[model samples]
Target: MRIAIFTDTFLPQINGVARTIGRLADTLTRNNIPCVVITPETKFQGQRNYELLVSPGLSLPFYPECLLSIPNYTETFQKLNSFKPDLIHVATEFSMGICGLKYASTTGLPIVSSYHTNFPQYLSYYKVEIIAMLAWKYLRWFHNMCLKSYCPSKSTLKLLKQQGIKNLEIWGRGVDTELYNPAKFDFSFRKRFGQNKKLLLYVGRLAPEKDIDILMKSFQMLNKKHRNSHLVIVGDGPLRQKLEQSAPPNVTFTGYLHGDELSRAYASSDIFVFPSTTETYGNVVLEAMSSGLPVVAAFSGGVRENLVNRINGLACSPRNVMDMVTAMERLITDETLRKELSLQARDHAMTKSWDTIFNKLILSYQEIVCLHNKVTA
Candidate 1:
């Protein structure tokens, strides 16, 4: 069946939602399913196998990396009519997603949505907690119109259900084990970044919502005791300059790395430290696990779904500096514990194959289309 995916984010953006949608497009192509991805025009050119329809957009003030597309209705409608997709997947709750919902309503097409980011939670980080209630109210209205609202983790599903959204389903993420394997480890990469020290890695945007302040504070505390350790922050955002300026010694910021370089960054690191409590599902956490690195992340939001304390990884209290420092210290000092968790992390990641996840998603799409056809007939 043909599918149309509407998202504010896409390839070359280097975020979780964008990366997930890119993989979905690739999977649809591999399965011989004709699909069209509707998104805002980006400056960076990316290679894709599916139809990519771009609309003029402006970058968000707070989050400059993401664009808010102002789609032309006539042009969008003509493209949708020509594509004639059986299903529409709204991957974000922004302008592009609203366009998709409107199209679905106008055409009586089956529509599904995926909840990727926790925007309401993010508002608190940006000091805009006043609009949080309004944000959730809008989200409820948006997702309730869809045939199904897919959440990346049980925790996220529970949150949406509490917010009065219906027909929720779990649509978890998966990693490419072959690419993010321990075999990708390179001593040279470690030497260059870590300076022959134990490398601690944190991958993802350096934004307020990521609780980067907590991460930096925790790393500083951890470094005091173990000066032999180094912290590597991957990915960049609006706070990159401020973070770099205030960062402690031995902390290296590798703006952004993709493909094999990113995989090597994961595999070469000794531990993965994530302090973000706003993730829908920690994609980098799984990627780190796939690379055989023990994780030390906040035990809140969707992160709790994957991180098992003292098992595959250690889950610390959210926003607590000392707690994160203690956890990182444990991993650094105990080689046996670190190695055991690394093995378990890799084994857990091996079970989550991208093919399996995408195939299941396709089945769900087919079911939604079939049910819609019956109702229309």
Candidate 2:
């Protein structure tokens, strides 16, 4: 099958959405499926079978790293038409994705999309809740072009459905157990921070929407008792400077780590403390579980689907500092419970296969193609 994906984000971007696109393209190419990526220019350099077409872009004001593309429609559409994709997948609701949507709509080609982020939640964080109604109205209209709008989490699917988006489906992410396993843990690396301290890891963007302040405050509260505990923040964002200033002495911020380094950080950590309540799907939570780390995350969104309190992981009430403090203390004090959850977390992660997830997505694409052919014929 020939597939074209138009998205604003692509590797080597640190976000889950960008990583997922790269993974999806690689998987498709390995399986002998023809796929093309239309994304904004990045400092990305990698080997791949699929084609990557970059468009003109400028950085977003609020989101420094995120770029909005300006594609020459005449040139882009000409190339897409010549490539003659069997189906199109619009992964972002930005410029490039809009161009793809326009092309598919005008040419009567089948289009499928995935809802990866909760922009409405993010708007509230940025204090742009005033434009939220207009945003949702626009989102609903944009996604209506999709043959099926796949959401990364069930909670998100229900959310979009309520927001008047039709044909919503679940398309959850899978973790790489081979890469993020306990066996990859490096004791020597842990010694760099503090050999004796229990590592508390947070691996995601440090921004208002991420609720990193809650994490810092919770860690500070936990630090008075657990003096030997360390907080490691392993991702960068616009709020990095502010977060660094607010963070306690025990906290250490590592800008970003990728590939093996990322896996090592996850495996070496004792507990994964995720305070973000705005996540549509917590990819890092799954990665932590794969690394056999007992996780402490907010009890909401996609994280809830994979985490079971005192089972694979523990979840506190979303954005509740006291609840997070209580849940975290349980794991820190009770060594036996911590180890038990670690084992269960790894086992739970094993069930999430990337191949299985991709195969299902491919099936959905084929179905869309079939339906489109019938309609055209």
Candidate 3:
């Protein structure tokens, strides 16, 4: 089957949405499915996929790393019709996604959308709180037209339902178990960072929307007794410079990491600390679990849904600095408890395979298409 996926961001961009969509395309290609990824052009090089199409874009203001595509609907549909995809999958709410929606509506083709980011909450962080209601109104209208709208986690789906979204389904994210495994643990991480003490790792975009200020304060709350503890923050974003300026001496920022180095970073850390209340689904939490690192995340969104209290990981009250500090201390103080939780965390991650999720998604697409055809006929 041929599939056309539309998104505002794709390869050369390092965010979760881009990375996840790229993985989906790879999965389709390996299975002999012709997948066309519609995205904004970047400094693309190497052997290009004939199926990947690009459009012009402007860099987003706050999120300079991610693009706001200047979509040409006529050109986009022209290329799309030539490809003749079975259905379209829209992955963003930007211009490119709108192009896909318009194309699908005009052609009476089945299309599905996935909710990735909580843009309204993100807007609140940017001091544009007034736009939150309008954003939700637009989101509800955009997604209601889809045959089925997928959310990355059950908790996320629940939130969407509460917000009056319809035709909701779960389409969870996955980690490369082989790539992010406990076997990747290397003492070299300790040697490089001069980490004689326990390492607390935080991975993902360093932005205001991420609730990163809470994470920084939590690290500082790690009392004088735990001064030996080190925090190694991976990934970069708008808040990087500000965070760096406020961070303590024990904190080391690694900018951004990819591939095996990223795997090693997760496996080497004693605990994974993600205080981001904004995540629709905490992909990094799943990766850290796969690497056998116990996660301490906000007890909200998808993170809470996946974590069993003191089982695989700990879920603290969102933005509660004292709760975060206590949770991290428990892991640091009790070596045996940490090891037990780590084992359980790996076990949990093992069950969430990308193959399983992708196959289910394909089945959902077929069902939606069949239903659409019947109704249209």
Best by lDDT: 1
Tens-digit lDDT track of model 1 for 239-326:
9999999988799999999999999999999999999999899999999999999999999998987898899999899999999999
Candidate 3, residue 63: Cα displacement in angstroms equals 2.3
Candidate 2 stretches greater than 4 Å from native: none
Those runs of model 1 whose alpha carbons end farther than 4 Å from true positions after fitting are 43-46
Q: What's the lDDT for all of these models? A: 0.92, 0.89, 0.87
Instruction: Please list the residue runs of candidate 3 whose C-alpha ends up more than 4 Å from where it truly belongs after superposition.
Output: 44-50
Candidate 3: the clashing residue pairs are none
User: Per-residue lDDT for 335 in model 3?
Assistant: 92
With a 3 Å backbone cut-off (N, CA, C), the pairs that clash in candidate 2 are none
Q: Can you write out model 2's per-residue Cα lDDT over 1-377, one digit (the tens) per residue?
A: 89999998888888889999999999999999999999898777899899888887887766655579999889888888888999999998989889899989888898989888888778888988999999999899989978899999888888899999999888889999999999999988799889888888999987898888788879888987888888889999989998888787888998999889989999999999998887788999999999999999998887887888989888888898988888788888889999999999999999999999999999988888998898889
